[model samples]
Target: MNAMTTLTYFFPRRVLRAVVVLLSCVCLAASAAESEAAEQPNIIFILADDLGYGDLSCYGQKNFKTPNLDRMAKEGMRFTQHYAGCTVCAPSRACLLSGQHTGHVHQRANGPIEFRPDPQDISIGRLLKNAGYHTAMIGKSGLACNSQNGNHPAEKGFDHFFGYISHGAAHRYYPQVLWRDGEKVQYPDNHGKEGKHYSTDMFVADAKEYIKEHKDGPFFLHLSLQAPHADLNVPAKWRDPFVGKFKEKPHTKDSHYRNETHPKATFAGMVTNLDDAVGQILDELKEQGIDENTIVMFASDNGPMSEGGWDRNFFNSGGPLKGGKRDMYEGGVRVPMIAWQPGKIAAGETSDHVSAFWDFVPTACEAAGIKPPADTDGLSYLPTLYGKGEQPEHDYLYWEFHERGGKQAVRQGDWKAVRLDFQTDPSRPLELYNLADDLAETKNVAAEHPEIVARMREIMRKAHVDTELFKIPAN
Candidate 1:
């Protein structure tokens, strides 16, 4: 007090009073900044594997109902023009987490062989984790290069990882073994027609536990669910709801994966089961009293698969869009996306926002008040999510698929250009469609609009940067 009074006496009375006020304001600002930092929300991104664009009732499915997903749409924002990273699994997930599109992303296909992400890769997990969010990746990690050598999810910036590292291994719904942070967990019961443990069930259980434990603060959970993909295997209890709902037909084909006795029932059952999983996660958040503060997003890795004895036509899985998986068409790349955040995102809203998986990394970073990597191609839709600030729109979105005779597609405004059979000849002309006029992509009006088509062709060539690993061959 003696020293403070002596120093205060040196200053004039008016100046002394102003200095005291300034000191108080500085203390208050520091406290406010701390409070804001502590309030960063938990972000949960639940990605479904091969669940079609029309799988959910809210997204125009007629045969089956995904009530939980529909409820998510009601509680959140449903994106109509949202697209997956790519047309298939590995590349799509790669494009997603890396915040890079197929053209610039490391992995570009489900592939000639299984691919894994690099340890140094700039992914959503890495970005959010650096921003102080406890990151965990649960369920199918289709981006792994192989079982062992490739960078594990932990190395790729996730604190914890549980599920199959290989996309190929994930095809077996009843996998004999699943990975938990590089350790293999055996499920001996997962051997025969009736496996003791279903992968989805285990995944959901772990997800609930993780949420309950981390309910306090910031966390990034990537729940990449491997449901409704193939094998068409759902527990009898879940399968019972959809039995006899559609025509009974045994799917016995010598395919890559196991065939189902009742493909349609099991297919619908799988989707409904996935819906239940989503509901469970939502319930857990509410129970933890973190519902409003948590940002829960749901989307599929890609569109519906026609393999594994699963019939896309029976389900009309693609909805009104053309083509299914393995193509660059809307059905293959476009997917259903729902973002739910109570007291944050507007309720009962539908956004025709043209967004993709690449946008997720930047979005999460921005929401957490962290700067995204400069090299990323993603644009944060945080403005759109919160309905505040300015939302930056993309001039174009690009994708290239290696399999199914090699395909490439680009979207600029309303014009969508797709070039197929390009592996043999990269110079092939693109099939053009104005998505604004023809959402089905049935009519190719390239002749009428040669200028747009030429621009698109240039974009297709310029957007892609050639890499030895993911090469677009020049014939």
Candidate 2:
């Protein structure tokens, strides 16, 4: 006899009816759950390594045009005052993932440092995964120093992870081996100096595949592309287009990165290649019919680097900002940020919201209709995106870098203060600037504004909590 016949025969009519009703309710609840999961929006965060704020044409690049990114800006909202977590890679990513600023984040510097988060600390991947979303991190994940330990991407709540586990490994454009979840996948063709495969292209392919596989429901894909970072290498197809577009000056120096024949052309090509990859991911989302249900955010990890023979001044990579890369100035920390979601975020909108990378976690949580962690240092700018509700503002933003003799910066209203050599001398004098009047931060008005300087110094002192690994001397 069938299971249903057996059940009916073993029970009374009322009991059998109750059994049927219970089964029906269970099925209905499951169906409702599946529907809810499908209804939640997909999130794709694309991070470009070492891409400058003004690298894209939309952000005032006169050297090369980023048509796809420009199109993305026109179709979505562009943020003019978005800042990265820090001036470097590892710490910056740590702050972004942990939803905390550099002041209280683990892995404050790049090196052979262990990424040991607090027991209560929740990563962005974990935050989304707990909400019934499939999470995937494709491309460079510079947080972990050891992949086998608890610091691995898998352990950090990513359901699927593919790419370099360390920052040093990510410097190469043609990597010999890449991590697939917890396994190391080898590429024999890319074993030597020259290779048939490019790392960024592989990352894009994997990202596209992940989107296709998870097209039905809620998913969070962190697509981190290592491009325009170093080596100044790209296939002829991407580099050839900009070969003769600019004045020629070959880079033949032997440094950390390989020398380039035409540094400017190759750099421009790398950016354009990055732009193309973004376009492909967008196209894939549209083809899967999830464009309206997916929100794509594009931003660089930090500012541009002068490494790998790439010319920052030739391309004006930092735009009107004061310094590039390593510095604590606007050019180093401020980066280009774009958000695209059809029928959700308004089109052709530009917001001067002073948001930072740490805010991503809360903003994404709010977008997915979930609550962010209570200990998070970031505030969601969801209201600004939808042009509804009263958007919250930050009282101040803080950043501290361990490298380059230690740097600390604080931004409050129109005033900005920077302190150098803080690790050695915590009571160092701060260089103050009125950003409202001098956006470039060319002048130091610390002597003129003593009270403001005192207030900023107090903030810097209180914001930083000394850690065992990266400690700032007590004031």
Candidate 3:
């Protein structure tokens, strides 16, 4: 009944209750963090619009500057001979997200597409989402040109979405509005085409905000840049920095004339702007203290459209590869690729192994420690990136693009074959090149190696079966 007796009697039971609650909370917190980390590695797949193999300083372009991209090359693995699925944007992006080569994923060509990503077809976000990683696609979606369709990023299995639904919409950059999580999120800059505003800045700002907010867990950030593409204008401040350094009318490696009004200079400026954007995002990763755990990959969706690709004439965006976009040549599909993940991939290492855009889905899944959805076509390049694996992870990397220039290529080991197939007929004169000996693809060895051509055709048959081309409307 005294004060000391009452206090002593009540204190022990309450102390015991407090100890149990604290221990339980600690266990729950630890469990949540472990579950988060186990979902996979954080991935940032940065796709540059219409970028070329030689645009980056590290790849081969000399006139223009790209300190950030070059710096990434220094810290990560660089693929000397990388490729896109198609010569154009939409198909290339489709193959990339689907993990199927053009032949195995997208059945048709150049877009402004008529159809959306097939619901049946697996997407990178969908595959990763199934395995528990938080997936998103920001910036240019490249899924559809129209706003009303189901081609928005959210429809493709992305948990969070921003940027434009189509590449055409992003041409405005500082457009009137941007879509966030499948709806329009209005912004102040409503410059309605009388004068286009700077968009690369807007894209990077949103991307940085996303990274800042998502640092506590793993994320798949596809910050697909719309810069250096078309309408070729940017913040004049960035352009003025290199007005005199490059010539515009492009100069192609061939007798074909390069488009210059001093186009290369504008292209270079665009490249520089993209580099600055990359710097912003990478800086954020470092600031957030998640740089080491992040797997960041930088690659072009396809080759240059102009003579210099991103730049204009003075610079060669495709380096020593063959033709530019819309062609079946190496320059059309081949691109520069850099994969950076600190404390994982070997620094400054270069690989001649053939890599196409489809590899991204599987590689990201692998880095995140997540398994892709069932029946996925991607094979992870994780071991190769780390320098612990063998050469040629893929038996054959195939493509099918039917636009102004309809073509397809298959690379099996050192042997490569390309076809000039019409919309209905894929069986035609196949161009075979031993890429090991000829990087530019100047000579046709199909006549010399009939056996190799046959093998490539056999590969195409399987690709056709897997792609199910018959389902596509034949119009």
Candidate 4:
């Protein structure tokens, strides 16, 4: 202080003023840098319903055409060993949105857990909203969290909401009514065959409008798209592209090329329509010049059900992984995941660091320079997204889905244990696989590793509280 005062006296008033101004500018720059580092990335989390790990062209499914998704994959990082927390929609959505595992939310399979938590339980959308982000939920939503007024998107921190609460409305490409921020935004009262609307188109339109409106500010869009899910009804404008295909159910087809069959071709059409929607959103982002600042994450709710999906012997739904949809197998849990950020994330990068559904909540928070709420099961993958981290996100992954009805599985490091509910009588046999060696889960090593099974059982025991039903069912 003495030296500074002496220098100020010697330099006179103008010098002192200049020095003060320069120092202030430096401080301001430092503050701005800190803010810039903490600045949010406009996030667009696109989730496809019942979309398989191998469904997209980027994921190596030769049968289906997912050009938009493939393009997005090429622009960013792709994870080969990503998984869904639950095998079905309701629980999976609950886990992903809450940043906790299904156990924490007491949501398992389609309806194992009931009752939505109070709106303050800290969901991703809510966190973003708390951080002053313009949030929206643009598609399928089914959660047992604050949905008494049925958890409409805005109440959950989504400023804009479009789409349906039921998984059925999403299952259809067109519906009679869609919810817009807790209100029933319906379509034509009666469809007389003139000016018929498609659901995919409607979702895309809403997504585009949202983007067009919010590109200037930091925004988060949960574009939960329902495609390749079920019902097998696609409009002619979308379906006309694929007239020949295969069956959704168990049917036999002997065609070297998948397009020749009825079901496969129909499935291809569904995928194409979904891809078109993806293109539309991306285009909107580009048109608005927010493509570079935006970080978009794409994934499916779960693996294909092996029913009403790209169901064919040739179409390896999980593609080299064993199990489909409900089982605690690779095919069922592991699905394709892509993260794209222009000029930030490396293009065409691939990682196998064991990511999961819960990771997104924290990851998005990190991107926004916000901290995750306490009691979250997820860890941020922001460092990994920028290709900086080496350690895997989680050392162990657990699954308790009723999809296999009564299946319990746990994965620690490279080892995994899977026990079917009714394999025998009341006691089902546990099957263990070293996923490092057997991605297909073709061999069971549980008999050889009793100690590991005991240790895993202990892990499950400690994690029991998360699985307990936190709230009773409605009615």
- TM-scores for candidates 1 onward, in order: 0.91, 0.94, 0.84, 0.84
* Alpha-carbon RMSD, candidate 2: 2.6
Best by TM-score, which number? 2
Clash number for each model: 4, 0, 23, 16
Candidate 2 per-residue C-alpha lDDT over 84-123 given as tens digits, one digit per residue, 9 for 90 to 100: 9999888888788888998888777777764555354578
lDDT string for model 3 (231-328, tens) is 55566677687777644444334332222344545666778999989888888999999888888888888888863333333466678888887877
Q: Write the per-residue lDDT of candidate 1 for residues 170-263, one digit (tens) a residue.
A: 7777889788877888888787345888888889999999998988878999998888887778899888878887787787865567767788
TM-score of candidate 2 to 2 decimals: 0.94
**Residue 255 miss distance in model 3 (angstroms):** 27
Between candidates 1 and 4, which one is better according to TM-score?
A: 1
lDDT computed for candidate 3 = 0.73
Q: How much lDDT does each candidate structure score?
A: 0.85, 0.87, 0.73, 0.73
Score candidate 2 by lDDT: 0.87
Question: How well does candidate 4 score on lDDT at residue 368?
Answer: 83
